[model samples]
Target: MATTTEADIHITKGHEVLKLYQFNTHTARHYFCSVCGIYTHHQRRSNPQEYGFNVACLEDVDPFELGEVPLGDGVNHPADRN
Candidate 1:
């Protein structure tokens, strides 16, 4: 059977808000939140340097406020690509 580890956790936070951005495919941009001491999802750091997706199970996020957004691919680091 497969195993679940701490890395598999969807929701993660630090002392500050993380500006998660995308670098390429599998990597995400991680930053710290300065205002509320949380980690907001952005993109990936090793991916394409863009805010593509967010954690499906985050907190205090207003669905009506955000609306329905599309999803992109983020499975591989840029350097690892051909």
Candidate 2:
């Protein structure tokens, strides 16, 4: 069981939550809640400061789910912000 908490979630911008991957950076390559087939958020390689969110989309997230916040940065983040 890959249970995660608010501390597990990376960042939140507005109403969107940021999720991350330890190895993968491709936003679409990661999967969320395979058991429930839910897609939360995805790892972002460009702005490693936070994960990219699928705002119009989400699933299986409880009402009390951690509100999205900001992430300082990630390990090996791209130097250029372009």
Candidate 3:
């Protein structure tokens, strides 16, 4: 996932077809393409100031090229602890 600040993300197009999904406390906002149901990005619950986007969604970007990607621990979400 590639990250950007909340102020930096600008959806120039296809904003109409984006579907939002929220879970638990509903603090996080996850967006997906309404047509094909592919994940687009999400406003992070852990860090509301940032948005995490699916890097695979971008054109000509190979995940393999970005070796040893770091992973987050989702099972122990901060919201759940709170």
Q: What is the TM-score of each candidate against the true structure?
A: 0.26, 0.30, 0.77
- Arranged by lDDT with the best first, the candidates are 3, 1, 2
Ranking by TM-score: 3, 2, 1
Model 1 weakest lDDT span, ten residues long: 1-10
Q: What value does the lDDT take at residue 70 in candidate 2?
A: 48
Give me the displacement of residue 78 in model 2, in angstroms.
16
Which candidate tops TM-score?
3
Comparing 1 and 3 on TM-score, the stronger one = 3
Instruction: For candidate 2, write residues 1-82 as lDDT tens digits.
Output: 1223334564343223323335543532343543444565654444444454434343465534556744446564445556
Report how far residue 64 has shifted in candidate 2, in Å.
19
Model 1 lDDT vs. the true structure?
0.44
After TM-score superposition, the amount by which residue 54's alpha carbon in candidate 1 deviates from its true location, in angstroms, is: 5.2
Q: What ranges in model 3 sit over 4 Å off?
A: 72-82
Q: Looking at model 2, report the run of 10 residues with the lowest lDDT sum.
A: 11-20
Q: Evaluate candidate 3 by giving its C-alpha RMSD to the native, one decimal.
A: 2.5
